[model samples]
Target: MAQIQASIEIDAPIDKVWSIVSDLDSEPKFWKGTKEVRNISKEGNTITREVTIAFKDSKCMQTVTLYPKEKIQIQFTKGVIEGTKALTLAQTGSKTRLDVIWDMKLTGMMGMFTGMIKKHIQSGSEQALESIKQEAQR
Candidate 1:
């Protein structure tokens, strides 16, 4: 069990950020790794999705449960990385703060490279937050 926590300040009001963040299907608009997101089903505030992330020779399937703009919990039901990720947002002053907490374990042979996995994920997460900030500010 490894954990990575990070946050970024977006230059936008909370509502403006929420509007973009709450629309789960818009991830490809800001995230490069994400190729597409399709909502499989929704019940009330929770949504289940089939997420596709582009990689060499593969298309990863991530089953995710999203709680609107408050949080998103993900499990990679089909991929080399299998674990959980929770992303949340909060308001700070007049800006929006996005925070990410990732708890993950690598699948199969990849499990042997725990340190590398965390570092890689942390780096990717930081980049993703930066992209989110840019998209929200636009």
Candidate 2:
């Protein structure tokens, strides 16, 4: 198993940051690699959503369970990352810090390039957090 964690400080109140980060469906727009997100169903904080991820000549499907305003965790119940968890919006000195914890088991060719893959994904996460900050602050 491999793990990658990334964090960013957003210049905004926690609540405001939470409002944007908690919205699971809007993640694709902010996270470039995400192609689509469709809520399959929802029961309170647990929501099952189908996520499409863009890649070279292919796409991957991932089922994500979200704890809005707090966390968004994903796993390939059926692609790349066996599991992924993103913890959002921790308040600190008037700013919101967003953190992501990704745990995965890479297979085939993907396994050989774990370091590069992790960096790319972490960068995307950082970009997403930046987008959230801009949206919330505006």
Candidate 3:
């Protein structure tokens, strides 16, 4: 298993940040690499989403759960990389600190490219945070 992480401080209150993050339909506006997000199904608190990445040739199916203002967890149910990811939020004074962690497992020969995958995830996380911050601050 490989893990990648990134953190950013958003110039917004935790409530505003949580509101933006919890809105599933607004995901693509702030999520990096995601070109489109389609809600496949929803059952209570769990939702299945189909996500298409901008440069990727294929899409991924993920199960997502929102824990209000605390965290958002995602598990890759079907995709090239299989694993779980999370976004955690903490409020400090007037700012909200957002942390993103990606825990992924590669298959076959892809396991040899762990370093590249980690870099990719870290970069994506940073981009996603910046986008989210902008949206939340607005």
Candidate 4:
């Protein structure tokens, strides 16, 4: 599996940061790789959704579980990618540290391009975190 991680410290409280990150539908605004999201089902804190990623406009099925103000776990259940992506939050005084980790591998023949894809995902994760920090600090 290929692993990628990104983190940012926002000048805001944990709740303030959580409020922004927990809004799954607004992900595309900050996450450039995620072009669109369509909810397939929701049960309490768990949501199964279809996410259209920028790579080849491919649609992936993700099971997302929100852990209040602490973390958000996303499991890629279907599509070209397979694995988990987690967003975790930590509170330090008045600042909140947000971290995103992706542990995944491309499926089938796409597995050969794992290195290239890893770079793209890593860059995208960093960009997304920066965007989130800007919104949370505002």
Q: Whole-model Cα lDDT per candidate? A: 0.75, 0.71, 0.84, 0.95
Q: Candidate 3, which ten residues in sequence have the lowest lDDT sum?
A: 51-60
lDDT of 1 by residue, 32-102 (tens): 65778877777776566677665432345566666665777777677766778877888888888998898
| Per-residue alpha-carbon lDDT of candidate 4 for residues 1-138, written as tens digits (9 for 90 to 100) | 998999899999999999999999999999999999999999999999999999899899999999999999999999999999999999999999999999999999989998998999999999999999999888
TM-score of each: 0.80, 0.81, 0.87, 0.98
| Models ranked on lDDT | 4, 3, 1, 2
Which regions of candidate 1 fall more than 4 Å away from where they truly are? Answer: 55-63
Question: How far is 75's C-alpha from truth in model 2 (Å)?
Answer: 3.4
| Native-structure RMSD, model 1 | 2.4
Better of 1 and 2 by lDDT: 1
What local lDDT score does residue 132 receive in model 4, on the 0 to 100 scale? 93
In angstroms, what RMSD does candidate 4 have relative to the true structure? 0.6
Error in Å for residue 37 of model 1: 2.3
Q: Tell me how candidate 3 scores on lDDT.
A: 0.84
Candidate 4, residue 131: Cα displacement in angstroms equals 0.4
**Candidate 4: residue 6 Cα off by (Å):** 0.9
- Highest TM-score: give the candidate number: 4
lDDT for model 1 comes to: 0.75
User: How do the residues 1-138 of candidate 3 rate in per-residue lDDT, one tens digit apiece?
Assistant: 888888999999999999888887887777666778899899888899998865444588899998889999999888666788899999999999999888887555667876776777678778888888888888
**Clash counts for all predictions:** 0, 0, 0, 0
Displacement of the residue 28 alpha carbon in candidate 2, Å = 1.0
TM-score-wise, the better of 2 and 3 is 3
Using lDDT as the yardstick, the better of models 2 and 3 is 3
